[model samples]
Target: MVKKLISVGSILIPTVLTILIVNFLFDIVPLNIQGLPLVLPFVICPIGAVLGLIGYKMNRDNLARAGMIFNIVLFLFPIAFNIIGTLSGGV
Candidate 1:
């Protein structure tokens, strides 16, 4: 149960950080001096991915898979958003 909780946390934290980073990047959210959101996802998502992979190897399949998916989406979203914005003249 504890491992499952960690897996869920691994998913949620990075996902939320991704949203915050994107919002900050696009100026949708006001910036503060503490810019952890700017740098945290790069650290957190990779760590989460590693943890998820370890969990998968240990057979905690569902939660681990969810974590991996969330980590992947967190990494990809900003790049995809930027590309779409550029193409659509929204950037």
Candidate 2:
């Protein structure tokens, strides 16, 4: 049960971060939080990914796998975006 919760949290944290980032980018709300984009990808996502990996190793199941996948994607997302942006002259 605890392991499953960790997996679920790993998946959820990134999803929420993505939503917050998108909202901030589009100016959908008055998000005055500073350094959120950098913090989410660098600090939060890596932690989530590590937790997910541990959960997956402990459980060896599909939910854990999904959590691992989500965390990895989220963690890599900013780096990938930066590379593409530089290549496309957006950076």
Candidate 3:
């Protein structure tokens, strides 16, 4: 049961991070909103990565791999955006 919960978290964390990052990128959520976008991607990404690794080690193949991939993309997305934004002169 614990392992199952961890597996679920491995997927959920990155999924949520992706949603948050997208919202941040597009300003879909109003900045007037308080505390919603305060989440730290650095913290969440590592947690997702660790959980995904655990899930994989525990043989939860699909969920684990999906979580790992999502975590990677989530971690990279912001850096990529920053690079693009810089190249585009803060687009």
Candidate 4:
């Protein structure tokens, strides 16, 4: 039960954060402080991925696997976004 909850949270938290990050990056949501939005994802995504890993180890569930995969993608998202932005001359 507890493991499942953690697994769900690992999925939810990063998904929400990823949405916010994408919004911020694309200027859909205006944020006054430039660096503020980025800091959380770098810290949180890894934590979420780790939590998912731990949950998967404990319960052998699909939710944990999904969570981990999402977090990994989330972790790479910024780098990819930046690369694309650079190649395109500021996205």
Best by lDDT: 4
lDDT of 1 by residue, 1-91 (tens): 7677667776777778867877677878677835666556667788888878777777767988888888877867656766888999965
TM-score of each: 0.66, 0.80, 0.80, 0.82
Model 3 sits at a Cα RMSD from the real structure of: 2.8
Residue-level lDDT tens digits of model 4 in 1-91: 7988999988997988877777776888687767655667778899999989999999989999999999998888777767987999965
Q: Give the per-residue lDDT of model 3 (tens digit) for 36-79.
A: 44345667888898898998899768888888888877777667
Each model's Cα RMSD: 3.5, 2.0, 2.8, 2.3
Candidate 3 Cα lDDT to native: 0.76
Where does candidate 2 clash, by residue pair? none
List clash counts for every candidate, in order.
0, 0, 0, 0
* Candidate 3 vs 4: which has more lDDT: 4
Identify the runs in model 1 with alpha carbons over 4 angstroms from their true place.
Answer: 18-40
Q: Which residue segments of model 2 deviate by more than 4 Å? A: 89-91
- What are the clashing pairs of model 3? none
Error of 4 at 35 (Å): 4.3
* Candidate scoring better on TM-score of 1 and 2: 2
What value does the lDDT take at residue 12 in candidate 2?
85
Every candidate's lDDT: 0.75, 0.79, 0.76, 0.84
